[model samples]
Target chain A: PNADAYGAARERLRNQARPAGSLGILEEVGARLAGIFGTIDVRLDRKIVITCAGDHGICAEGVSRFPQKVTPQMVYNFVGGGASVSVLARHAGAEVRVADLGVDWDFAPDLPIYHKKVRKGTANFAAVPAMTREEAVRSIEAGIEIVDELTAEGPVHLIGTGDMGIGNTSPSTAIIAAYSNIPVPELTGRGTGIDDDGLRKKIAAIEKGLALHRPDPKDPVGVLEKVGGLEIGGLAGLVIGAAAHGIPVVCDGLIATAGALIACELAPSARPYLFAGHNSVEVGHRYMLEHLGLQPLLHLEFRLGEGTGAALAMTLMDAATRILAEIKTFAEVGINDAQ
Target chain B: PNADAYGAARERLRNQARPAGSLGILEEVGARLAGIFGTIDVRLDRKIVITCAGDHGICAEGVSRFPQKVTPQMVYNFVGGGASVSVLARHAGAEVRVADLGVDWDFAPDLPIYHKKVRKGTANFAAVPAMTREEAVRSIEAGIEIVDELTAEGPVHLIGTGDMGIGNTSPSTAIIAAYSNIPVPELTGRGTGIDDDGLRKKIAAIEKGLALHRPDPKDPVGVLEKVGGLEIGGLAGLVIGAAAHGIPVVCDGLIATAGALIACELAPSARPYLFAGHNSVEVGHRYMLEHLGLQPLLHLEFRLGEGTGAALAMTLMDAATRILAEIKTFAEVGINDAQ
Candidate 1:
């Protein structure tokens, strides 16, 4: 958060063994992390990805084009190792575990479940508060518990939060508006490939939710309890935990950005550990990125959730760290002049 | 290339564990290589990069913004491991070696050198032929010899071509125009970030060369003798050798594209093994890509040519091969969805 640290990081990156400003924004990210950690030899070791799957109560409002069943189906896809995030996790060589934060489905009692299902999904947040404040805190504590368990084994190097909830973007937009103080219409967008008509209905639903909640922006927890989804609350906890434990966190698209906005409100210093993976097609994503003053690594018009963009951006982070760690300095190579 | 074999290769890729068209252009490339090598599983082993360093006589015609000395200076950068290609090759995990194809420098005999200099770089083709037929043959033979030596040691999986020559774009434009039959002015671009005035002069110089050479498009060898740089001729040989030896070759940006165009002419079947790495900012690159019917994997607006694009693209090839070799099929994993 110190502007001086940002300047020093940029200076260190400029001094790396390459042309000035050649690596582009990746150079700045590496430098910023180096300055934050107060070490030139910064490495990402305990990479953690927490995939939170839930069902959106807003699905009852008929907002998403896809059936709400797709949420559970995609979670099965993740568990069955057939989802994009599964393949991406293999590529990133990161540890991934799923959280059943608040999906409607009830699992067998002895099954391997990481987090609690606070309720069988929320009431239609369009007409009422998604969950009670107690339920929201319980979900946040679920995420905090995961981070605590993972970091107890070792220091988490980087944390990535992903979500799998259909019709959740309406809730996300409302949360983004409450935290960022942006207009509701500007923060609304077509989630899961909704048409213009669907987008209009979605925006109107979010406006109703905002009216019902009347969230106070000064209190982060109060704002989340008013408008946020369970996954958003869990992600906020993950972000706070990673920052508290001195691990960097890379936030995925719009939904994750909403979580990060709350995390920043809770602990302002968490913004430094956060890297925006890519700009999502969601209008609210642009608002969140602009509010956070973070630029994404790639812009291939990707809007898929499930942390695919974050996984791909991790490749760039690996590359940057390798360059900083492996490249021989001018002194080591001993090149005289331009010869 | 056998059309049947190519079809079979495509079938194998489509039958892979992932979704159809998920790998994009790489799926086609891997399939085509499978056809070339007559194997279902293709591995990228013994990757080789042939860096052709030369001096363009057009530098004498004031075609380049940088001095002629930068060509040899960059060659030293490549050899000393400071150039972009050097870092890219380190990332690609490939073996890179430089060839002094036609630089205007006398070197010690004991130095590690591939002495295939053709009259200390070509004559200014705007005024005269870039190289005589005999000299062109010599340069091509030198490139083939390098490939033969490398492949003789073991199976050479991927061959990438890079070049270092000041004002080489002048020769590259002439070669591209001769091959693509496009207008010289339309194919010429500002090489090495030339200004508007420099670009106009470069175009004028290429037009003059086209007037002087009047190359026959049908005769690939004759066209090379008339207008191609020594590095282009060498690249043609590299491509030919890779095809004859049944090795996949990855071609870099515009200059390498010119070499690939010549190779495709010399042996039409060789086109199957050629992979365009990335689209460069060079004006002739799009025409060259069109002629080859190859779509590059990445479009990063990269103009810095050192075979760095090819080297970076090699990472994708590596990823594809790893999937082919390591990933378990549905049947192997005991999943009923096996194709």
Candidate 2:
């Protein structure tokens, strides 16, 4: 990111017809866009949201209210343009691209989703590692590969990270615990609306997995291998790849922010290109966002994490960039600002 | 608002493919739209934002950072489609309609603005009533008359209220003070980036206005005549008119919401039709929203009051209504929810 461009963009925004600093986060977004693109004349016409789906082994412990099969079903709904994210992306004038990272079910060869499965699924982390370290690396590479394929076709202005897996939030919580001194109970939440017993089981399952793996915070990849979901890893790669390409990535909800936290840990340069789409209802989401030093753009209490939040916020990004590029300065509008 | 339709919408939303309460504020907005439109199938295709421009006599007290001349200057910016609200409303697929209720300057007859001037401007509220009770009523009636003329052309799906006036915050704070026992100091804020001395002067002006007027809370018309600006009264009528026509009205920041507060007091039924666009940095705005039992849709800390906040959140309303009408139910998608 270019600091000079960021400063220049801020100066430009200060001269817009409105009072300085009145647009709030939109102004910040404009400056950040200028920083990322190294120019204030950046266009974000090609917007895309990639929702990665992969089953979590933690569902065997009854950690989620929905069945694991819902993962593939939702993926079908996504491709069929019937899910929340699909509807929202269309409303935002952005395209929805689905990816199969490590779902247990086999999709047909003609399915529209990206065929990037690393394994059927990972082993249960309560009794064994979620995946070998190599598999974790593969999942991250898959996301980067998707970015490469996308950029080859066209200049992608923005990418929003989304996730789908029934028990995914459990691993998201576990990953947050790996990085912070916060207890598992504090980081745990009702994934897919779990009951009291389901909540207790989720907490215990994370505690047991953490105790067995004892994942080191210094080794982010090792921690992901021990407890993170494949979709989470893929999302982390999406963040890293977006930053590598100088594209802004909006991370949705708890699991997506967990992915962002890992991406920031792996590559500190990715931090500036990331935007937390919203503050999710999940308690652990705030912790993960704080860990990443990111402020969410919206606080609508969204917990449906199929990139719906990102899709909604992409419109604000549109507003921000337009304010930077379109709105005439005070001098151009002939308004005396000395008053 | 139709309670039965609202209940039916909730039931329908629960049956959607995602988990029952996952969409959060969007879901609430969906159900609220159902209530207002008296059906689950509400379409917000024709949207409009009415920005009422007036001048404040309270500028005589050195209560603002911007000069009073800027009110007409911004009115020109709004009509010329260069202001923040104009750009954002275009982005949100809404039309910008400028209404000159009591601006201090005269706009040309061919400027393409609503010719509904009630007066040149309000009197200095710190020393005298802002307007006569009859003029206040006339200003509000002008707003309702705009709605009537708009509906005559075609049905308006949504109407957003905005305001443009110099030192209008002084009168807004005075209005809030008239309704609440909260200290004037706590309710006061630096409108348009005033310094510490300007802030002190603003607080003193509002305090003096309220002490002299002693506006009766029960008589909302007298309250507007005593302490509110003409644009504020006009916005109050916009809210009332929107509710009368069963259209959802998204109220922008401080000045817009003060109008909503007065409208709710005048016509208790208008309360259900109001949606706060975003929480403003202005302290008294939240107090007024709370008084009307309204929750803001966005919390972007936006303080630019030319309906920019309303324009941004209007897209969310579009998404919400689309979610309610478009997403397939679990049964329709053949996804078993009993699992």
Candidate 3:
């Protein structure tokens, strides 16, 4: 953090003609943005959310309502600019980049998505380990390369994380349960508003994955290799890569937060680089956030995990940055401060 | 609310390619806005926040950190477009209309504010009623006329409530305590970050007003006449007028919520027409929202009573409306539903 810039931002806020501290959390948001950029005049441009599309073989267990085919179809929708993340990213003045992580289906060579498929899809963790350790490492490196390539044009200030894989939440729950002693039922939710029967199946499947993989709780990489999905590993690498380059990563919802948890477990130093986009309606979301010690910026009760929440939060963060940079001080505006 | 429009909006959302209810509470927000406008296609072209500026007479009890003189000066700040609400409202693409609900000091006759001063200020409520019943009725009417005149050309679709008054939280705490049997200390917060001594004084002041006025909890108008500020009265009327015109009123933090409580208490039908912008950091805000059966859209830890929170929420509401009206359904987009 730049003490000088933080001081300058606080001074400007103090003299903004309204009562001091009246802006509440916004004043802190402004000061923090200033600290992030190491300057009082912080501005965000050319923001992008990387939506990694993949598939979950665990969908065959009837854990999710939708078929795994929806993943590739949603990737097509992303290419045609019709997906939720597409609309919301554009709405928030940010671009979207949909990358193929490990979907089971193959795309045409001419498709616009960058192909870094570690495999067709992860092995159903309920039956076996999801991926080999080497494959997991390669997934992380692939995410790092994606961010590095995107920022090669110019430094991207904010990076949002999104994933599209049906039944991925089952694996997400497994990963959290593998590390923490939280019960599967406590960490499970209606992934797609499932019925009581479906939820029971989902919880059973998660427990089966834990029993089959026997993931080492002390080893984050082993846990990812055993129980986590490819997109999850990629998101973890994206967070680590962003921290390596001194940029902030805005995490979407539960799946992305699972990836973030893996990243934080892998490297505790990467924790500060992550920002929660919104509190998810998923029952396990509060547990994950409490584990992270982060608060989300919005609460619209969004259950979709498409980086849509991240896109909206990018706009609010931009607004906070603008306030820190644009508003005039008492000395500049010739207004008396409240006494 | 229009049932047909609500149904249409839901149908559109259901077929929008996302999972049903994946948008969660935003789906309800969209449907409500559609119902409010009597169309599935809802648009807000001209939105305005009425920032009612006033002063409280209870400051004489040594309850606030700042003097009462800061009220008009901040009003000047609002007019000059330099206050937090001014900057945030403009940032959210909403116009601000600052009116003189009752400031202790007078402005120039041709100043760029509506001169609807109910009185120089309220009487010292520690010893007497704040205003007579006639003055209370006139203040409410003045607020109604302000909205009526502003929407004379075309009805404003959204109205935001903001207030400026020193020592006003004292009265707000008193209002909440009057209706609910909650203790004052449990309901009160450090308004404007008052010190321990100032907080003690504020609680003592509220207790004095309650002891002296003995305002009836059942009689909201009588309570306002005895204990509430003129701006609070005006805000209640603004809410009523917005409801009368079939517009959505986005309620801000604590002080504005105090006014909203009065409005809902006066006309029960007005309750559905109001949207909570954010939950206030003030502890009583929870009690108030629970009483109204309303959940705020955002929880950014904002306690600023300016329509700033409302402005931010207006942006979100606009986003929800656009998603409802503009997004293509499954038939239009040629996309299969997740199921």
Candidate 4:
């Protein structure tokens, strides 16, 4: 992000017809937007939410409430405009793009879904590496290529990270655990509303995976291959791709944020272009957000991730940029700020 | 609120193609909106934000950073589409309605503002009662009348409470201090960027006024007469009026919530129709919302209370209602919830 542009935007915001810094987080958001767009004239008119789906073999441990078949089912629901993110993205006036990273199902050829399959599904990290290093790199590249293809079609102003996978939260939480000394149990949460026994099983599985893999935080690709899902890798690529194209990325809840953590590790410059969409109910969501130094825009206590948080947050980004563009300065309004 | 309608709405929400209660706070908001509208079909279209401007003689006590003249100036800014709320309301697709309850400045008839001024301003509560009980009732009735008139023109779907009054926070905090045993200074905050000395003076003034007025929580009207701005009283009426008309009211920051407190105390039945738009940075805002048993939708830390928070919340209300109206059910998509 351009610091000079951010500073200039802040000065402009301070002069708007309101008390200085009274818009609170919005003022910071508007300035950051100006920095990202490299101008005060920021337009988030063309927005898209990328909902990436994959399957997790970790579901074999009974870590989630739903079966792995639900992943492909949800992708169809997303395309059919029936999912939560579908309605929300439509409400936000953004198009929803469904991508299959490695779901363990074959979608029909006529379906309007991106067929970017890296593998059938990730291997259970508790017993083996989630994916090969080559597959992990390929997954990220697929995401980057998606963004490139979309922007090639038009000037894509913003992108939102979304995910659909059974037991995906297991890998998301493990990613956070690898970055911090926080206990696996502390970072783990009940995905899709699990019982106490299921939660305990989840914690033990993550602990086992961590113990076996001993993933290094330094080599993010190695970590991704060892314990990350294909969709997560794609989402990380989405973040890096968005930053590379100078477009802002609104990262959804825990899973998308896990992807973001990996993206930032690989390319620290992408950190400046990202917005934590909301503080989810997942215990590790806020912890991971703090690690990334991103302040979430919404606190709706949302736990369902399909870019819903990102879609809602896009409205705020629109408001912030519109504020910078539409609101007149105190001088234009002939109002004395000191008075 | 209609309990039967709310339950029915919740049932429908559960039948939609998502996890049961996964949308979290939004699911509740959608159901409550259905209850308010008395059906599963909720329409938040044709939204309006009523910004009632008044003045406080309490400004003479040095409790605020800006002069009382800034109140009328802001009303002009709001009318001219140059204020923070103006841009935000426009962004949210809501119309801005500026009303004068007790502003000191006089305006020509050509200006597009509601001419409902009860008095030039209220008396300093630190020295005497803010208004006669008769004037307090009139202010609230003025708010109710405005809502009635607007709805009479068309089927109004939603209303948001906003206020513009210098030293208004002093009286607002006083209203809360009357109900709670919390320290007066704890409830008081820097209004419009006041210095520590100004804050000390504000707290001292509120404490002095509460001691002098001895406002009772049971007699809400008496409390308003003793320690409320005309805009606050008007906003209280707005909540009551919105409830009587079955239109949801999105209550904005400290001053707006202070008015809502008075409204709920006077008519407990109206409490169900109110939504705390966003938790402001004001010290007493959340405390007052808690007292009203209201949960804010957004946590943007917004302090510019010209219906700005309410306008932003209207979009969420739209999204929540649209979720119920647009998203497909499991049966419609031929998907089994158990899977």
Note the clash tally of each candidate: 0, 0, 0, 0
- Model 2, position B183, has a per-residue lDDT of 91
* TM-score of every model versus the real structure: 0.77, 0.98, 0.95, 0.99
Q: Could you give candidate 3's per-residue lDDT for residues A1-339 as a string of tens digits?
A: 567777888988887665677666667777877876888777778788998877887877789988778788888887888777887887788999888889999899889877889999998888888899998898888888888888887879889998888888888888878767798999898987788988988998889889877889778889988888999988888898888887888899888888888889888988867888888888677777888888788788888887878887887887787667766666665555454
Q: What's the true lDDT of residue B310 in model 1?
A: 82
Across A1-339, the per-residue lDDT of candidate 4 in tens digits comes to 888999999999888877888888988999999998889989888999999999998888889888788888889889988888998998898999999999999998789988899999999999999999999999999999999999999999999999999899999999999998699988998988889999988998899999999999999998899989999999999999999999999999999999999999999989988998999999999899999998999988788899999998999999999888788887888876544
Q: Go through the candidates in order and give each one's C-alpha lDDT.
A: 0.74, 0.91, 0.83, 0.91
Better of 1 and 2 by lDDT: 2
Docking class of 3: medium
Question: How well is each residue in A99-197 modelled by candidate 1, as lDDT tens digits?
Answer: 788787876665444656777777787777788889888777777788888888777677888877878788788877886777888888767667788
How do these models rank on TM-score, best leading? 4, 2, 3, 1
Q: List, residue by residue over B65-118, the lDDT tens digit for candidate 3.
A: 777887887787788887777777876789998889899997999998878999
> Model 2: which docking level applies?
medium
Q: Cα RMSD for candidate 2? A: 1.2
lDDT of 4 by residue, B169-213 (tens): 889999988877688988887878899889888888898999888
Model 4 chain B poorest 10 in a row by lDDT = B330-339
Worst 10 residues of 2 chain B by lDDT: B330-339
Output the worst ten-in-a-row residue range by lDDT, candidate 1 chain B.
Answer: B330-339
Better of 3 and 4 by DockQ: 4
The CAPRI quality class of candidate 4 comes to medium
